[model samples]
Target: MVDRFVEGAEAHAMMDRLARKYLGSERFEWLMPGEERIAVIVRPTKVRHIVGVERFRPGGPVPAS
Candidate 1:
């Protein structure tokens, strides 16, 4: 699994790259709420899946597991 923490334009660029490389002609589905900063989770399987996205709120406490 690969994870990336990105914000602003970098986040947009990363998503664009993933869409071009992995999603191809298919539409990408966002399974989580959009935020200014986020953690992208990439999982490997038969097909690579962008399985999870974690939103980060500034000044907010980290969520407990």
Candidate 2:
């Protein structure tokens, strides 16, 4: 999908409209470690891929990999 966008085979404007309609804000949560001192609402689906990749471990204990 990223490749498609980078190659201009995908229309980012159309994608953004669709995302807005379906997700109604693309809202999500993030929690900081220790004491609940900080939190955030993340709205970018693309960034989630990076975050997931960071948390993912190949051939490790987590099932996500």
Candidate 3:
């Protein structure tokens, strides 16, 4: 995940994106009670698969993962 703090225009843009995604409908807009907003950006990390199922079965040897 992307672990970092953001500010300025970038943060504002992100906030709008979040608002659209979370409170898209007009009915849901009421849920947004505050003028100011917070945005969070999460980047997916590479999935490192150390071991696959093929390495282990029934009584087969279990590979180190």
Best by lDDT: 1
Residue 56 in model 1: lDDT: 62
Regions of model 3 farther than 4 Å from truth: 25-65
In model 3, the number of clashes is: 0
Q: Using TM-score as the measure, name the better of candidate 1 and candidate 2.
A: 1
Model 1, residue 43: C-alpha shift (Å): 14
Candidate 3 residues 1-65, lDDT tens each?
87776765677676666555555633324334555544566777886667654545776454445
Q: What lDDT would each prediction earn against the true structure?
A: 0.59, 0.38, 0.58
Worst 10 residues of 1 by lDDT: 23-32
User: For candidate 1, lDDT tens digit of each residue in 1-65?
Assistant: 66555667777666767665566633335635755645476766566446586546885545355
Which candidate ranks first by TM-score, i.e. highest? 3
- Which residue pairs does candidate 1 place in steric collision? none
Among all windows of ten consecutive residues in candidate 2, which has the lowest summed lDDT?
Answer: 1-10
* Candidate order, lDDT descending: 1, 3, 2
Residues 1-65, model 2: lDDT tens digits:
22222212233344444455555555222323532222222455454344434553665444232
